[model samples]
Target: MKYLVMVQGSQADYDALGGKASAHSPAWSEKELRAMSSFMEELNNDLAESGEMVDGNGLAAPAATRLVGLGEDGRPVITDGPYGETKELLAGYWVLDCESLERVTEIAERVLRAPAPEGSPVYPVVIRPIPDAGGGDV
Candidate 1:
């Protein structure tokens, strides 16, 4: 079975990583950022070696996000993110092919252990199962 594991953050988190401080989070120092990044790389590499990692990627900052919807007249209307700095957003995700939900839960536990700056707030990693071609849940 396949699972989608998500990492959540806020615009303030991204800003901090880029050396910008906000009311929500402090600016991340170079050393802190390096450690965080290295941890992620190592985790991905381990998952890849285990053949459970199917796909994964980090998303761009909230500033670059766009929202598209249909206008009252049925035309597409696009707008910038306009997201609050403290609003939770998707920071990244990993797709893992695992033997059981327990395995995915274990992976999520490991993801939660990723390095972060001291006193940084932690968010729970979200996980959802991917259904097979049939409409039934796998």
Candidate 2:
């Protein structure tokens, strides 16, 4: 089976950091940044060696995103994001081909353990099964 492991982040959290660029900006000491990078690289290596990792990548900041909707005149209207009441944005994702949702959940939990800012709260991870060609969850 295949699933998308979503790493989510709250908009309030982003705003608290001043904005998108500043959120991932070099405000952190170089040592902190290097440690985070090394931790992720090691994690990704483990996943790859286990043959569970299909693909994974981080997304650009929300401020760089846009919301598209129809205007009153029936034209496409594009607005910058940091969108509505929903607080979370997808910070990153990993596609894993695994035997069960249980395994995927375990992987998600492990991802949550990756290095992050000190004092940061644990964030949510969404696990959704990918559809197979027959239009069913894989």
Measured by TM-score, the strongest candidate is: 1
State each candidate's clash count.
0, 0
- Candidate 1 lDDT, tens digit per residue, 45-91? 99999999999999998888998999999999998984665478888
User: Against the correct fold, how does model 2 do in TM-score?
Assistant: 0.79
How big is the positional error of residue 61 in model 2, measured in Å on the Cα after superposition? Answer: 0.9
lDDT of 2 by residue, 73-131 (tens): 99999989777665578988999999898999998888888765565546778999998
List TM-score per model, in order. 0.93, 0.79
> How much lDDT does candidate 1 score?
0.89
lDDT of each: 0.89, 0.76
RMSD list, candidates in order: 1.7, 3.8
The C-alpha local distance difference test score for the whole of candidate 2 amounts to: 0.76
Ten-residue region with minimum lDDT total, candidate 2: 19-28
